[model samples]
Target: MATKRVAADVPVVRVDGRELRPGQSFQGIEYRGKDKDGNDVWRILVYAGDKWVETPDGKRKRVVKTDKHTFTGTFRDAKKFKAKLEAERQDGTYTPPSKETVAGYLREWLDTTARRALRPSTHAIYEVNVNKHIIPALGHIRLQKLDSNTIDRFYSSLEDKLSPATIMKIHTILLSALSKAKADGIIKQNPAKNATPPRVEDPEITVLTQEQLDRLLETAKGTRIYALLYTLAYTGLRLGEALQLRWSDVDLDRGVLYVLHKTKTKSSIRAVSLDDDVVAVLRQHKEEQDEIKEIEGERYQDMGLVFATERGTPPSPSNLRNRYLYPLCAKAGVPRINFHALRHTHASLLMAANVHPKIISERLGHASIETTADRYQHLFPTLQAEALEQYKEYRRKHGKGG
Candidate 1:
């Protein structure tokens, strides 16, 4: 009779002079020869205690489950790692490796951890990135098998299809997810820490000149979008932030508006002062809206939004951009610009008047003064030249310089 081959009965793999066998125990550490990269490889097998399993005859047998690691480093490093593993074993802190896939872990994480921690809008973005981009590429890889090189390759693959700034956003999401996995003891470390993402250059900011802005407002005057456009230009608020504004949040008497919802950060929730012209425009806008509400009666869907459609519902951002803003820019004979450029226009106007950067940072609701400074640093050279000219004029007047 021929004997059936068992897993342990198979041939042993010889690396250099060392013998490697399946399920074999090591004293502490063993040299496993060099890897493909010519780095010395070592193996460590630590006993992880045992459990009971049913035998063929309905009897019970003790099955010892060992935690093993193949280290790609020197034997000395392997010994140190072995010692660490032994220490963890002594304290019952070591986690056995898992065979879960990246997709499985990410799905679980998004449903439980990320959903609880992230805001609704932010969480929606994360979900789209994960389901649409990440899972399709890296989902098949085992969670334990994922490494920095794999992540780097994945990022490289996206270079042709996505912009550097967009790729950076994806990297941020992956890094956050992997960081949580490490904290939960699901992975030994975050692979994203070593992965290299594409570099994003600081883009040249676009802003409308004061004359161009005047023409734009003139073209948009008496139109429904005028108030929204004026608000964005003067307040420097993001399109989403302005759209989320409520009637209650605006105080026409106090000459200020509170940014309560759709704010990017805690710093973004601030009181933005309104100019007299802006206050007057808003008061007129309110009266017109009240008349429309009375005309619509109960048919209007009033959600207290300051900017809404004729039915009192929030207007679509795409419609505002394509249907209104672009056409208005053409009619006004001004260079076409996105709504965000209006915010830049406001900041540029303030900077031209020599407004303090600290006040600018506060008004823009930047997380730090450094952020504001870094963004507008391109405009500083002209300001510096002007300052030097002013100093020279002062010296000439006082007869201090020839």
Candidate 2:
């Protein structure tokens, strides 16, 4: 049934044995019939004060603004909401109802604020989440109509189809986008702050032992991606970081790599030292690349990427995974692991060798040593025992043992 505005002459409506009337907080509360479940629905009216509006002739006129919020709960609930609306209006953070759909706003946000502010890869991720997941579920709803309850329900609906980690990523996108909308005064507040998302526990990290690493490298010895895999094992560079490396970024003489772009954080944009073996491997790879460039002549892309396809074009991750990584792991008889496992293998091996955690942190480009310690906390006790054993060995050598 449609709801009509309550006139001043209407009889008082008794709610919970209390007579309700217009007061400082609300102008009136109307009983808008029961909902589908037979619960009384009350529409609370509040004075939203005055606002300057433009007329058809382009002249500004001051007009009184009023707000009606429909609530499907007890009388106390309606009163509380009325108070909240009045407070929002007084503070100038009240968002009037708008017809802007969630999909329209999110797509605009992705094209404008997110494009210039986020890295290209990050922007692509946002675009995918908005189009593939978020928009399909909640895009048709008005921007201002989005509430915490709606978001909570949406997250629950995705539980069967997506992993908790993937759902968490979706939550992050929504929270970030809605926070921007709030900051821009498009919404009164961020509803995402109150919505609950699934908790994602850190997965077990898999790394190869020295023997396994040897077998994997041996299997990749003569392959085109050999140098890239070798660099990952020796330097612990991320797959993206290693793939995007340029000839200018690598210093063979100094045995160092300058990571300038596509990094996860500001701390990731640091210099990483290379092992002598890895440096030599890169030198040979460079020679091989130069010969290919001469053979291909003008067909070569000349992007200067250190790890590229035969035509000097950047290699896709899928190609690296499907064509090389999987086959090499199978042939080498090692456990099939993703590219990131090589980075873990490198870090774990260094820690096993009694290298300082600070050095490991810097090498891995971690934001802080604490991050390294937390990530590899499982290995510290053994390292500590080894340190004590070394102390005993030193004492024995000096003839000061107990």
Candidate 3:
């Protein structure tokens, strides 16, 4: 007689040993026996893939499979575990992991999922970090073996070699990849869950003072990049956004510019109200562009870009920075910040003038007002102080003070 009766429902689990590789035999437990405590326990068996082993030891150890796994112990905990395993199998969202390494999984994940899901530039960045940083550092480790402690040590080693910002980017890619692995059931848990990456240091925003702005603009007068740089300063436009502007998007009479195209983010699409002075500068720029177009005749590439070279092509950002903006900044004796500082200068001037963050966010084409506040959080306390002072004066006049 059988020692114990098998239950109709059990979680079928497969835990294989190493002997299956050579094709001489296979090794695993067949869920068909009872332990000394009268609870069912698994028994080991060998197979040749689909065929059962007929050797004396194999036959003695073997038992039949009925799509059920052995279970024992207290009714509650065992039932819960069995249900979970069965649910996972039925849903097909997960499976037992085969022999795979972390590097192999990450490469496949990037190629199959991240490459198409992320934006082109973002994918390029992920590719660089994965291929250069992550795979090289921990590729040999098995997916199951990776742990938060290992990742923490890796981050610690990189502390002195990479900036906090770059390290954070690398960590973000690893976390994302590992997260996908967990979701796919390739691993039981994501090792990066509790991993500590270097905290990103707040970047020092380079905002040009009013005096510096005056000098830089004055120095840029009559220079090729004057209009481009001036528009950025006056309108709080990001460098890439300013470069992508077109004539049709500008409404000089109404003093408005439609941001129909942005080089970086689609969320930045919105209309921006331009200052009267900025409109005048753009008008002058348009006239100059026409003159250049006439001079170049058929050779000019008229793609309608607002900021372009004499040949009507959009000027390379690096070329414009090195050949023009930097030299002008040096001549003006300013901090010599890059073209992006002009956008910062614009936002700072607005804040100094007591403009609201929502308005600044719109002008700068930021994705959200929170982005503006976070980027300029250091300036916000000063704004609060100024407002309180104004409130105090109002209260004094109303009756509180002589």
Alpha-carbon error at 89 in model 3, in Å?
A: 4.6
Better of 2 and 3 by TM-score: 2
Cα deviation at 312, candidate 2, in Å, is 2.1
lDDT tens digits by residue: candidate 3, 154-237: 999888888989899988888888899888777777778799888886779999999999999999999998998889889877
**Candidate 3 wrong stretches, greater than 4 Å:** 1-94, 99-112, 142-145, 262-267, 296-299, 367-370, 395-402
Which 10 successive residues of model 3 have the least lDDT summed? Answer: 18-27
Model 1: weakest 10-residue lDDT segment is: 1-10
Alpha-carbon error at 105 in model 2, in Å? 2.1
- lDDT values of the candidates? 0.86, 0.87, 0.77
What's model 3's overall lDDT?
0.77
Per residue, candidate 2 scores C-alpha lDDT tens digits across 319-387 of 899999999999999999999999999999999988888999999999999999999898888888999
**Model 2 clash tally?**
0
When superposed on Cα atoms, how far off is each prediction in RMSD?
Answer: 5.7, 4.9, 9.9
Global lDDT for candidate 2?
Answer: 0.87
Give me the runs in candidate 2 sitting further than 4 Å from their true place.
1-84, 398-402
Model 2 lDDT, residue 385, Cα: 95
TM-score of each: 0.82, 0.83, 0.72
lDDT of 1 by residue, 1-402 (tens): 011224755534443345554444345666555567856566788897899999999999999978767777655567788888889778867756677899999999899988998888789988998998899999999887899999999999999999999889889988988998888888878999999999999887998989999999999999989999999999999999998999999999999999998689999999999999999888998899999999999999999999999899989988999999999999999999989999899988898888998888888899998998899888899888988898988888886554
